[model samples]
Target: MAVSDQIVRWRYRLVPDHLLGEILTKRWVDNAIPVLILIVVAAVFGWLIPDFFSAAGISSLMRQWGEFTLIALALMIVMVAGGIDLSVGSTFALGNIVALTLITVAGWPVPAVIGATLACGALVGLVNGVLVGYLRLRAFLTTLVTLIIVRAIVDMMLLKYSVAIAAGFVDSDLWYYFGEGDVLGVPFSVATALVLALVAHLVLSRSRVGWHVLAVGGSRRSAHNVGIPVRRVICLTYVVSGTLAALSGVLFASRLGGAGADTGVGLEIAALTAAVLGGNSLGGGRGSAAKAIIGAIIVMIMVNGLVRIGVTRGGSSLLLGMVLLAAVAIDVRWLKNRHKFLSKVYVSPTYSELPEAPATSGSSPYALNDRLRPVEAIGLGQIDGPEDVILDEDDHIYVGNRTGDIVRFFAPDYTRQEVFVHVGGRPLGMAFAKDGALLVCIGGMGLYSIGRDRSIRKLTDETNRSWLSVIDDSRLRLADDLDIAPDGRVFFSEATVRYEMHEWPVDCLESRGNGRIICYDPNTGTTRTVIKNLLFPNGICMMHDGQSFLFAETWACRVSRYWFDGPKKGTVEVVIGDLPGYPDNINRASDGTYWLALVGVRTPSLDLALKMPGFRRRMARRIAPDEWLYPNINTGCVVRFDETGRIIETLWDFGGENHPMITSMREHKGHLYIGGILNNRVGRLKLDGMDPTWSGIDSYWRRT
Candidate 1:
């Protein structure tokens, strides 16, 4: 190979699509970049400008940014978690006015004064939280109304006692020193901001509360359903925001030597601008307190620098607005479109190399015996929400359904069937254990092994981190297609913590991509994440060799292979891509091939959504869910794939013209039985010439 070709190969081996393997992708950079750029720009300009680099100039910058930084940090917490507070500015102004009135006129001690100010702010926050969180008021409107009411109250206070504060009755020194004081070359206000920023950063980055906040921001419904104290978290965040705004107000009053009408005026916009520019998203579930403060600092420096360059205050305001607009524009449009640039300049389309079709086509396929035909449709009327089916020694067919019920179909003719046992919640996938016990994947529960006596035993339900939030209905949303390896280790898919069975499509639009595949070792009885952040991971089937497993990503429309043995163990490979439909329950075929069920085909509209995130996210936020925006029941189908990742055959249901939506398909006694959530009766199909090796666990009954 040429030296240049070798260098190219080395680079590919070194990086090789960084997002594929890394557990944590760098999501925070989009928020951090602007602030970083601003800091660099400011430093360079200050170096060139004579007065701009001086200690006095730097102190001036600190004094200017003091109020904005404090408020922005508070805003960052709320915004990052997918929330907002409009009353921050009002609370800030009120804090200053209240603190001044208490210290100067009421003669309260400093501690009492500060406490009173914070309590007042907290009260406003509590009101906002109650309205937005519990009352289910729209966050934007609820906070807007609160902002008006709080501002009116502040104006009333000002009107009642403006003269007293301005005339120096408040002993200005107490407020003045705090705003201007310095220790060891650091401004007191700057030091205070730093301490608070550091503390907030640690709490958000290192604590579990922070994770809850992010989850809530990402999807409030998902968060609440999954057992996050959504109301409490929302309410408390507002209180924190109000308190921080109040702190900013107190400092501002001190710096100005008196509280005035202009105090904290338009501060809400400034804080929001800083939060957005710093990378705290208005949409939520993605933000940092550190970036928010940096954003505020950037805004302050821009305004201060423009003034230093002889721009009028009016011009500076225009320039700042322009700059903020530009930053937002860059984030929303440029960065997302950068993918187009990458495709054109550096590499070919990464999706072109995926497997296209099965090995056999356009030939008259061989047919199995006539016995398989009617048998395939025999269990149709008996199955409801049937996730998986297995056969036992007594010619009894055991089907695991998601509603925590197992249905039994008497074999030879799967005609006599009854609800075997009610396990509670949803059950997805199942496999026959070596001991004749049935291993089941119970959604909202965990892995379970059922005995012949109709009793269920929990194998493993939890993971290493007990601190990780597991909501009640989803204490464990383990789903479709589990397999027991040779060593008795069980592996399955979490599907999505963001959406339930009824709302699976919502997971696609949210695009937070929080699904993971997990493994449970029976010997150790421990569960670990085999692959994290696979987009809407749906199905998991242990490979034929048992050294690796094949799993499907429903949203990504692809199947991936994860290894558990050898040097390449734990590594994931995209075995197939650009699936024609959303892949569902995967099971090992009797022929050593894998049968994959395509629950729904990807329509043109949904496929186009992959390129437009903002549009999809907006729809998620705005569209009435009952609106039926995407194609549903009509396109349900199934596909068969071999071990080589080739699509061998396709089964089209079209929801049976009113009864499609197939989820799980188990080949039993040379027949195919299908079931899904909304289906009233399972679908059955006869394979005339299919291989006899297609018998699944359900075939054990035929042997018996």
Candidate 2:
């Protein structure tokens, strides 16, 4: 290899360029910005303020954070339900006054006062729910009106009860505990808030109620169409917000023991800023308890720190306004452009150098011929994308198609067909178990089987994951093909780990070694990867020797044999290298040979372009997807080869009348059946000088 070639090899091969795209695709990545900001904000404030990290200062900060967290959480809940609660500040003031009046004037018990406070908040929420949800009033205007009405009522109550609240006092242990207690170095309010946050997180993330809330937030009309009670869900979200806000007021009232006229004024704006600054979406349908809590902590720290550092209240509010504006702008742009960014970095192209194509021009072994063009078409226009074909013991033809159905045709005439079973995922490669069970590889699913009784069963959906893999490889992404070993162990190929079944073309364009061969042992019901870093590994066929198997690497355009039981066990060797086209399914021929499907022929232009990864990357970015260069899948052919890796002969569909893309073939009763991934029909060609009694079923399952 040239020095330049070696440099390119190490650059693409060693550097894992796919990691960033993989990380960006995860849902948790959305929290990254808020967490980073939280760290930086804390650092900046701690440095700016004297003794900000002192034991007493930290405890005071936690107390404030705990109360503010509840109010922010209340706002987040309403936002996630596609509504906004502007009256939370007023409702919080109501709870504060209600608690002070009960404790000071009415001499009520602590528990009873708490219940009464919560009830008042719930009553206010019911009014909001009835108007905004049931009456179809806009949330913004309705909540704003309610905010004014609730604040007016709180002002009246405070004016009437303030003198008595300051004059009378009750010394209660429970009230003091709630106000200033500590639990193992954590503040009383902090401990309480953390527990509630955990419960709220579970209810929102891990329960059906949470799903409904998110659904309502995402789309009210769609949620209603899907049988979700849109009005009820929205109403319930407001009630939850009111109840949580009241509870926060309960803590605050206990801490301060009284309220003034200006209590809770402008509190709603601060809570809204905290909620949005934590990365909760303002457009609704996206938020979390963690985000609410993080936002509250940052706000509480910044505000309290600013006050202690001699910054005026107005200056602190100004800074908060700026932060909220910036946060809202970021959330909108990130939502709109995340996928656009992904499209650029996600399809990372790596260096690939396909070997020189063999001479397929006139008089060569692979010279073009219209052998398959005259073949009889089976189930034409009646089937969809039959990717693999097989014969049962009775010579009944079966083929797996893209529609996720296995269609069967009666042998005498191939005109009629019926769906044998629906697999829910596109069925690709297939083989038989010892007892005649049809083992199938389901794309985007995993290995499954159909018994003689027509029962479907999942064999395995996952394998052991690689420790160093950045992305989860345990779950099968696309199981392309499979074959059963003599010991009943099933060997299968996963075409590409990075791309799903629909993105197979993209995977091919990258030409990375994202494919792997996995084996599932029936005896232990365990699956594991046997070969890693294959280039689009497809068809799997247990070699006639019963000790090895022939597997095709579609993009690599080669056939390779893996030994499982012989002396060369745990090793692989190339059987046919440098084919003129991409190989698909490999099956056994009647006379001790192997039949391989060349799904797409190689082109000189494409072969040359594959070696230059930089040019391909530019093409993918600059051109529309349909205009991009793709593998030349225009020619369909099949070649017969021996164990010694010599191509015996080739059959070509020069005109591609029936099999436009030959993906698989089977031989039985002296007739060859062909299947294609892009063709709507299967083809059958009568072979002369062949054994009529020869069948794939007997070839593998018959007694010696």
Candidate 3:
């Protein structure tokens, strides 16, 4: 019975074996591929070479490999600071000469020699720092000069001192320990390198200095503007580089038992190779110390094993060069082409509303009045959440759904809806670009355009801001609505970074408004903030008079107008206030009236509850996903008001079995197409008798 139960458990564990296998495969591709290649090479070499994996062999390998690891670390630090130190090899030789001269000529103690050697390294670093940082020289050219100058100094010192094995020199106990001894099964030199590596990792990964390093690497001008002390960070990296190189020189002296002319020769190439192999880009700003260490290890293993297998030093160098070239090729190819791969893998469209309503030819769409009736309800279905609606001159309705899809419906008869674009973020608002493309506001993804061919691509994701950091998905969040000017400039709103779409109500309840309106110029292809610190700005509408425009302040329950031209250019004024409910989509009516949709009705009970701050705070702190604590969607209505902000009419749908939410309204060819965030079907209601002369103009009907 026990055996049977154990078998049952094992079977259960493997019940979802296919899913586990797929997950493991993806994980291997993401992380283990690089490590696996190194392992394979090591294994093949070890199998072919006699005792290559033995303890003695590893000791020899590690001690000799410490210098390469040190160099790689040095390069990594510089790379992180958005610079490079090509003079590390020469500085390393200088360190060895400094230590030897101190011990032999001055008869200094080992500790004093050590201090002098490190200080010498620091001096070299300081020189490099001054040239590149303070002097403002290009890193490549400045370091190149230092590399030659430092090497010349090293050669001059070597000749003057006649420092050879024959010179009266005693290798001290401390030197031997630093060079050859092991502590608790780890080599002392490797341990020292590891300690430095850990310190570098912490500084680069955790500290504020690290962020500055990344910032500088990403863009020097950007870093400078943000007051990151870019010059200091650049200077410090070279200093760290020189110090590390000097330490490597000391390790070299200990390993070889004497300082030689060629103590640090060819190290620059190896360090560069290792850094690139470990995945540090030559371009800088995108490297890690840990990766450099791994790269150094790979190079070390190859050299050591190749020597054991009787490969000449020259031949081994050739192979290392080939490996470095391959890594560079791979990096370049991925950087250039990976976006297409990622887009294809991630962007999936859920639904496309048909063009025009399904033609049920029983009656006229607006039989009640000559004016078409507005949409009574719109169902979100599995995915809809329409936030804005527009109608084209041809009576085609455009709907920007929060699900990130733009659907178009052809009109006269409300039928034939189809998905026009599959934008990969929550799409909020859209308008026709001057060149006839669809300019879309994709929340959390930035501004984008759907070309005539319907290809969705990013436009201006970030504005010209100094303090902003635009990492992958780090910058823009919750872009809500937009309107286009006659001059081809587009103004939009980024609602709040602290709260996303699902959490927007939380932001409203908190009343900590953090929203801004930005303008994007198609001619210049630039986006800038036009107005800052708005309270949940939602819809943006260009005025019919061509002077300025109005935008809905959702939380404040008001509409504000901003003047673009004439005497009051760049000024703002509130046109409407004290809305009865959350104001949503706004459009021009058939009879030159403006229609605004109020998705929910504000009751006195809800208003009093909203005033109690503790209620919302408690709900935010304790509410579960399944919990429901706000207004019921079942009792919502849509209202239309004229340009003077007076109520023209009300469209009421008492939430029940028929329709629940009425969020967006667009008038098309005498008919108003309605949309809701939560509903699953588009609703329609006919007006008995209204204006018949209305045509669906591009300005009046913008959603489609």
**Separate clash counts for every candidate:** 18, 0, 42
TM-score of every model?
0.57, 0.96, 0.53
Local error of candidate 1 at residue 239 (angstroms): 6.9
* Tens digit per residue, CA lDDT, model 2, 647-701: 8889998866657788999888898899888888888999877788898777887
lDDT of each: 0.69, 0.88, 0.70
Model 2 clash count equals 0
- Cα lDDT for residue 290, candidate 1: 72
What root-mean-square deviation over C-alphas does model 1 reach? 9.9
Q: Which rank order by TM-score, best down to worst?
A: 2, 1, 3
357-456: candidate 3 lDDT, tens digit per residue:
2111234221112122334443335346666666555657777665668888666554567888878687777677756677878877788988879887
Candidates ranked, most accurate by lDDT first: 2, 3, 1
The reply for model 2, stretches above 4 Å from the true place, is none
Number of the top-ranking candidate, with TM-score as the measure: 2
- Report the C-alpha lDDT of model 1 over 127-233, residue by residue, as the tens digit: 98888877878888888898899888888998987777777555546556777887677877888888888888888878899888888888999999999999888
Off by over 4 Å in 3: 1-33, 162-166, 169-171, 348-704
TM-score of 1: 0.57
Largest lDDT belongs to which candidate? Answer: 2
